[model samples]
Target: MGWLDGYVALVTGGASGIGRAVVKRFIAEGCTGVGVMVRSAEQAQGLQDEFGDKVLTLMGDVRSPADNQAAVEATVARFGKLDTLVGNAGVWDFFAKLEKMPIEKVAESFDEIFGVNVKGYVLAAHAAAPNLRASGGSMIFTLSNSAFYAGGGGPLYVASKHAGVGLIKQLAYEFAPEVRVNGVAPGGTVTPLRGPVSLGKQGKSLSAIPGFEENVANVTPLRFIAQPEDHAGHYVLLASKENSCATTAAIIQSDGGWEIRPLR
Candidate 1:
């Protein structure tokens, strides 16, 4: 039997990037059912084409509590139970340095960033709580190195990540032995969450970070940036009953070697 032979999982932002990778990983590990809550109909169709009915695509905004509730309800209705909820939808904000950033930018960016990252997680957990309690399942949020360190994201994004770290602990306490809550912090993975794309013409030049890719590659003890698939295994491991029964409120840092680089 596969590690997740009878598991049913829901992945927010599941049509692309790390979320897509997680969905693929779960299916590969023998998860019996997987649902991907996407933000676009075209992306949802693409996932449906790829996985047929084994993957359910719900197009909804994570910012909406109603949408989150409906997605959770749809998953349980389709699969009979919900074993895992991957809160992987988030946004990045760049243009706003704390001092020079506009008040509107701060408000808009914080609202947008926290809307999906923080509120979405809370709503998803609230919606999935009873089902997870029934199955003694887990919830995993895709966080970033930004949660622990600065510079990956600007002021607003960094603050949002820090809040996510707190959410893991808070939810873990709330869910307890019945349902586990945790996060994965991956450093320099090539996720679609490129810095501040929404900032348009005013966004920071990601390429200007001084040999950003090569420097990141060199700094990591692993000696390379990771692909989304590289980070997916941890999700499977955490969701596995045998491997993770004793692990909860844990933040698995899949950050290559960002935490231990030599002083430069």
Candidate 2:
């Protein structure tokens, strides 16, 4: 039997990239149903086509409390109960350096970055807390290598991810004895991760950067760039209470062994 047989899950930003991979893996692990929160109708349709009734696709911004709440309510309504909540929505800053940015742009970029990365997770946790507690389920958030080290992104993106560490810790503490909270921090991976509009980089994607794959591979200790699927198993491990019951407020690093990268 699969680890998540009959379990129900909700994954924000589940339409593409790492989020999409997690949704698929959760199903393969025997999830009875998954609620996917996407940013567009097209993405929702795509998920519906691929997973059919196995997935409940919701279109909304993760930064909205109403939207997060709606997704949880809908998931519980359809699946009978909630088993896991994956907060994986986020935005990159495209490495926009501090001194290089216009003073006016920094504020806007900060809000957009934190709004999607940090606040989105908090909002999802807040919305899913009750349902997760009721089912004795857990929460998993998608963080980044940026969460621990520097040079992953600009100050805004890096700081936003770092904030996630504290959020997971505090939430784990607050929800203990009923629910567990954890995170998966992936390093550089090939995904369509976008940037903040305030920096005129909403159209830019991380994987689209020229030489990005090569550069990441050269620096990573594993000597290869990761695919979205590479990090999916970690989410499964964290979500499977049978497996990770004793694990909470922990982060599984899946970034090509960034810890062992040679010093420049």
Candidate 3:
């Protein structure tokens, strides 16, 4: 039997990239059903085409409390209960330095980055907390190397991710003994991770940056760039109470050994 057999989960930003991989992996691990929160109808349609009724696709922005609540309610309504809430939606700052940005732009970018990366997680946790507590389930958030170290992105993106570290810790403390809270921090992965609109980089993706893969591989201790799937198993491990029952307020780093990267 799969680790998540009979379990139900909700994954925000589940339409593409790491979120999509997590949804697929959760299903393969025998999740009875999965609720996917996406940004567009096209993404919902794509998920439906691929997973059919196995997935409940909700088109909404993660930054909205109403949308977050709706996603949780709809998931439990369809699946009978909620077992896991994966907060995986986020935006990059495209490495825009603080000094380089126009004063007005910094404020806008900060809001947009923190809105999606930090506020989104908080909203999801708030919306899913009751259901997850009822089921004695867990919460998992997608973090980044920026959460721990520097150079991952600009001040806004990095600081937002660092804020996630605090959120997970505090939430884990608050949810204790009933619901577990944790995170997965992935390093440089090849994905369509977009940037903040305020920086005029909403259309830019990390993977499209010329030589990004080569640059990441050269610096990463593992000597290779990761794919979204490379980090999916960490989510499974954390979500499976059977495996990680003793773990909470913990973050699994699936970032190509970034912690041990050679000093330059």
Candidate 4:
């Protein structure tokens, strides 16, 4: 039997990248239904075409409180309960150093990046808390290696991930004996991770950058770039009460040896 047999989940940004991968894997592991939060009609249609009635796609911005609540409500309404919340939506800063951007632009970019990366997780957790608590379920956030060490992104992106660390810990503490809270930190996966609009990079994606795959492989200790599927199993483990019941306020480092990168 699948680890998540009959489980119900809601995933933010579940239309693309790592989020989409997690949804695919969850279904394979026997989830009854998954509610996916997407930004466009295209994304909604794409999920429907792929997963059929087992998936419900909702259109909403992750940064909105109303949208987060609506997504959670819809998931429970359709599936009859909620077992997991995967807060996987985020924005990158594209390595824009603090000094390179004008102060005004930096301020705007910071807000946009943190709005999706940090606040999105917080709001999703808040919205899903009651259902998760009711089922003794959990919350799994997608973090990055940048959450622990530097150089994953510029200050704004890095700081946002670091904040996610604190958020997970605090939530785990507060939701103790019931809902668990945890994270998975990946490094340099070839996803369509987008940059902030404030930096004029709304149309740009991380995987579309020239030499990105090569550059990531060159610097990563594993000497290989990861696929979105590579990190999807971690979410499954964190979501499975039978598997990771004791895991709370902890982060699984799926960064391919990023912590051991050569000091030279």
Cα-based lDDT for every prediction: 0.83, 0.95, 0.95, 0.95
Error of 2 at 15 (Å): 0.3
Each prediction's TM-score against the native?
A: 0.92, 0.99, 0.99, 0.99
lDDT (C-alpha) at residue 158 in model 1: 81
- Model 4 per-residue lDDT tens digits across residues 1-264: 999999999999999999999999999999999999999999999999999999999999999999999999999999999999999999988899999999999889989999999999999999999999999999999999999999989999999999999999999999998999999999999989999889999999999999999999998889999999999999999999999988999999998899889997
Residue pairs whose backbone atoms clash in candidate 1 = none
Give the per-residue lDDT digits (tens) of candidate 1, residues 105-211: 66766677777778988898898899999999999999988899877767787888889899999999988979989899888766556453334522444434557
lDDT of 2 by residue, 147-254 (tens): 999999999999999999999999999999899999999999999999888898989999999999999999999999999999999999999989999999999999
Q: Which ten residues in a row have the lowest lDDT in candidate 1?
A: 196-205
Candidate 2, lDDT over the whole model: 0.95
Please say which candidate is ahead in lDDT: 2 or 4: 4
TM value for model 4:
0.99
RMSD of each: 2.4, 0.6, 0.6, 0.6
lDDT of 3 by residue, 1-264 (tens): 999999999999999999999999999999999999998889999999999999999988888999999999999999999999999999999889999989999888898999999999999999999999999999999999999999999999999999999999999999998999999999999999999888888899999999999999999998999999999999999999999999999999999998898887
- Which residues of candidate 4, in runs, are more than 4 Å off? none
RMSD of 4: 0.6
